[model samples]
Target: MFSGLITYLDSIRARDPAPRSRWEVLFYPGVWAVGLHRVAHWLFQARLYFLARFVNHFSRFLTAIDIHPGATIGRNFFIDHGFTVIGETAEIGDNVTIYQCVTLGGTNPTNGVGGKRHPTLEDNVIIGSGAQIIGPITIGQRGRVGANAVVTDDVPEGATMVGLKARSTLVPAEEWIKDFIPYGTPCDEPCEELMETGAGRLAELESQLAEMKAELAAIKAERAQPIKRNGTDD
Candidate 1:
């Protein structure tokens, strides 16, 4: 058990550069939150719902992280900072890292029945700060969601998602091969490439618009021409 704790702390250290030592990691709110969540989850599984809820509330009071007792979390699930909420039906896989102020939110069932309402994070998935992963969408393995993204769809494996409505950004092989990317975004090259692509698309659209205008003008000119009767001008 001690060795497993050490491994978990080391995993957090590997991801965060601010921690000077494992001892410092122990003092992190995220660490406390995960620890307390374990107790709450055990109680929840044992059918002690009240006790589980009490523990969960206490953990939230102490760590400012709200993880539902019913949520299933796998090994090395790290919440980097506080103000994160995990819904009841949320399922998180191993090595899933979530930054501050993220939500694994649920949607109301139309049939009024409880089911898988929250998002699922596959192994090695990273969710940046303030990201809202709504509904029962699954973020695939190695998927990276950028800060402030609002995702409502399933993310493909190894994809990088960004923007308000959260669209996947095309990442180069070299960039995608990295083991970890902070804030789940490769801003330098990928952003520039997107800009260039957008510009090219805009130019292509403008060219097509010009061609369409020319065709319309030709049609109008042909229609406006005087009609001829028996080869005579009318």
Candidate 2:
């Protein structure tokens, strides 16, 4: 058990560089949250709903991280910071890392029946801060979600998602080969290039729009001119 705890701390350290030692990691709210959640999940599995909820509430009160007792979590799942919410039907696989203020939220079903409404995150998935992963979507293995993204659809394996509606960004092979990316975003030269290209396209479109407006104004001016009879104004 001590060995497993050490391994978990090491995993967190691998992801976050802020901690100097394993003892420092012990003070993290995320560590306490996951630890208490284990007990809550065990009680939930035993059919002791009230006790499970009690533990869940206690953990949330202490850590500021709300994880439903009914949620299923796997080994080495690390929450980098606090203020994260995991819904009842959410299932997380091994080595999944979630940042602060992320929500593994569920969708409301019209049938009034509780089923798989939350998301399923596969192994090695990374969810950035403030990301909302809603519905019964499956985030495939090694998938990366950027900060503040709102994801409602299934994400393909090894895909990097960004933006408000969470569109996939094509990552270079070298970047993809890396094991972990902070905040689930690859802000390398490729990303910079894409941004530059988008800016250029926007500028081009604005210039075209300005030219079109000028042409329309000239046409209207020509139409408003008085009619002429044999080159003389009417």
Candidate 3:
């Protein structure tokens, strides 16, 4: 247990920039929640359901993070601020980073029973703040969920997901390994490169605008012409 705690501290330190010392990690709500979750999960595995819930409730009260005891979480799971919820039957893989207000939840709570209800996050997944991953969706390895995204479907491996409706674009995992991206925004392409890529789209919009202007001018010219009145000048 001590060794595991040490590893947890190391992982949190590696990811979070605010913590200055290992001792400070102990005060972090995420660390507290995850540490207690280990104990709760152990009791749950032993079939001590009541005891597990008791511990889980205590952890929630203490840390303000709610993680169901039945949820299976792998190693190196990091959570930022509080208010994160991981429902029962939710499975989280290793090296996952979840920010505040993230929810791994079910679509229909009453319908799912004795089965997987919540989402499954694969290894190296990054969930940005206020992201909601609902249903029995699988977030593939190295997947990124952008801030405030509402995802109800499976995300492919190495995908960068964004928006409320959740659109995704592939991002090479190798590029992600080079640097940490904040808010899960696509940063693989530099600003200049992105501008260069959008040149065609910009031109298309300009052409459409020009066509609209020409049509407007033609309408104005036709309106300006004298109106014919009964085959004679008015």
Candidate 4:
């Protein structure tokens, strides 16, 4: 357990720019939440239902990051900014990074039956802020969920997902692991400038098209007029 705690702290230190010392990491909400969760999960497995629930509830109240004792989370997991929610059946693998306001929630909340109602995230998964991964979908390893994306389907390995319903595009795992993107969207610096340029060019092309249509109408009007021959009235 101590080894797992050390790994979790190391993960937070490596990923997050803040926290220079062990004392600071000790004060981190994520660290405390995950640590408390380990103990609670053990209690849950031991059939100490009340104790487990109490610990989980206290952790939630303290951290603002709700993680059920029933959720199975692996080592080196990091949750940034707090306010994230992991459902009872949600499963998280090792080296996972989850940002603020992320939810691994169920589509059917009121069902009391025993089944996989929450999503599962594989190792090295990065979930951005405000991203909602609903249902019992499984996100593959090295997958990235962009900010504000709503993912309802299974994500493939080493893929980047973005948009409302979300779209997936494959990426090299080595490159993604090397350079970390904050929001997890693969839009580079040039892409932003290119988007602005494209919009301007589209508006310019529309104006030119309208001018050409006006000239064509004028030419057609001139051609429609009857040509009168000299010394002949028709």
- Candidate with best lDDT: 2
For TM-score, candidate 2 versus 4, the one ahead is 2
The superposed Cα distance between candidate 3 and the true structure at residue 99, in angstroms, equals 0.2
Question: Which run of 10 residues does model 2 get worst, by summed lDDT?
Answer: 191-200
Q: What clash count goes with each model?
A: 0, 0, 0, 0
Instruction: Rank candidates, lDDT, best first.
Output: 2, 1, 3, 4
Worst 10 residues of 3 by lDDT: 188-197
Q: After superposition, how far is residue 152 of candidate 4 from its true place, in Å?
A: 0.3
Name model 1 segments beyond 4 Å from true. Answer: 195-234
**What are the Cα lDDT values of the candidates?**
0.93, 0.93, 0.85, 0.84
Instruction: Please write out the lDDT profile of model 3 over residues 1-234, one tens digit for every residue.
Output: 899878888888888888889899878899889889999999999999999999999999998999999999999888889999999899999988999999999877575555878999999889999999999999998888988999999999877787778877545546557445565666544321334235555777889999999999999999999888999755
lDDT of 2 by residue, 40-144 (tens): 999999999999999999999999999999999999999988999999999999999999999999999999998999999999999999999999999999999
On lDDT, who's better, 3 or 4? Answer: 3
Model 3 regions lying over 4 Å from their true place? 109-112, 170-175, 187-200, 207-234
Task: Write one digit per residue (lDDT tens) for candidate 4, span 48-164.
Answer: 989999999999999998999999999788888799899989999988889999999987757667589899999989898999999999999878899999999999987788778
lDDT of 1 by residue, 2-88 (tens): 999999999999999998999999999999999999999999999999999999999999999999999999999889989999999
lDDT of 1 at 102: 97
TM-score of each: 0.84, 0.84, 0.79, 0.77
TM-score of 2: 0.84
Name the lDDT of candidate 3. 0.85
